[model samples]
Target: MIVKPRLPVINRAHPLAKGLVADYPFFERGGTTLRDISGNNNHGTLTSMDPAVKWILTSQGYGLDFDTTDYVTIPDSDILDFGTSPFFVETWIKTTVNNVRQVAVAKADVTGNFIFEMGTYRTLTANEIYCEFYVSGLYPKVLVVDSSFFDGKVHHLVAGHDGTAVRLFIDGVLRGSNVSAYGNIDTASWAIGTYGAYSPPFRGWNGQIAKTRVWKKAPIAREIATLYADPWALYRSRRGIIGKAVAAAGVTYPQLERSFQRGAFRGIKMGVAA
Candidate 1:
């Protein structure tokens, strides 16, 4: 005779649910951080930073007066770990040049292989703002933005190559797409606000930049859009109610929890005096 095994009954107060409830605060903390990165502190705008792992542009080196300030420079030794092929680059840029080349970020052999800046008219014309990436032995690939899309406003720009295709995003929207491969070139160091050539380096951006991030994986279109749509939301959620309340006021996690508990634990007295 075959005996039927009894099924395990799921308890209403299961450990999974309990853990989730207990850990909600931790998840909320991460949201707060995202809010901060997304410019919740200042007016809602993106920013950029130097790309070399340990180097950051100084205050005078990074703001709207980039034309007057000497370009912030980074040494090749600082970026020894960056791989050539699969990577992403994103920055927020404003230009001061009327009709000149302004490089926002670059990493290349000073003389030979370079992924640098290339553009003709700088007067916010169609395809006037763009970046060029040159692999050692391969044809260089260029990513351009139509002036109609980004123009002179503070805009978020992102570019990534994932072995198969190259993708570009403007303010979280996919604007350019192509297929390219950077085989085995070693891009030793990366600089921000200037081109890499010594003789006539593209000196300084004429605008502002903030919140630059580099990820190994090329973020998908949806993910990029989501980030652009509510850059502060992720950071805000991580902070939880207390942090959010402190940052923006009138909203607290405890207040929310109390409201939820009142509804969720209707019959059960949570074992505490009100």
Candidate 2:
């Protein structure tokens, strides 16, 4: 029997290089389309974007600015379904409005039909907000609370189900979690920058959002930490996947000096294979 060799992560940019389900760089100048660079066909349509002023550019590049009521929607498909399997979502957001709920990404419908919704929701305390990953009523998620996200600055946010617990990471730190358990997930259209489009209380996000990614896997803490430490790596990483893994996942690249060869492979770092 052949054994699969274990190797160090090639890029350490993010965990999504292997199981990227969707990617939105928010780079389209068309002002109406958010291209899915992941090649997963999960394209989104801008509800009310103006080519002239809807985008904001920084040293990192362009990002979509939402006005609470605006959001991007993706059509329903089989690949979007995550079921009870592990899954994760990551994105960069900047906003000061956290008094009420603000949805960053959601694929849910009321009346029992649901998948998941990740966003900032008002807590019992006045003006206090907490991040939530609502799976469904049957598997309601616990709040991942942290008050610093309302600072109106660029921050990395991540949430995921790691087969056991629902987790939330802010700026690469694991902030909170809850016991996670759910049956097969429903197939619903995806919405970004707001909650459900077919329902009320959209929980719109009034801010700039960019570099949203989804993966059908558990949360990888090291990957998140690396990305938070080197924010530019996120931008440096290629847009789409190269065949299976990320374009420069470092497997074949000798830059990292990581190596995984045939049989009883030594714990080697990637670099110019020699």
**How many pairs collide in each candidate, listed in order?**
19, 8
Q: Give the C-alpha miss distance for residue 252 in model 1, angstroms.
A: 19
On residues 41-145, what C-alpha lDDT tens digit does candidate 2 reach at each position?
788888866756776653233577888867888787777788778888888887787667778877766443546777677767433434444554565565655
lDDT value, residue 231 of candidate 1: 39
**Every candidate's lDDT:** 0.44, 0.64
- Compared with the true structure, model 1 gives a TM-score of 0.56
In model 2, what are the clashing residue pairs, if there are any?
254-271, 256-270, 257-269, 257-270, 257-271, 258-269, 258-270, 258-271
Off by over 4 Å in 1: 1-64, 77-80, 96-98, 116-127, 143-145, 149-151, 185-187, 197-203, 232-236, 242-274
TM-score of 2: 0.74
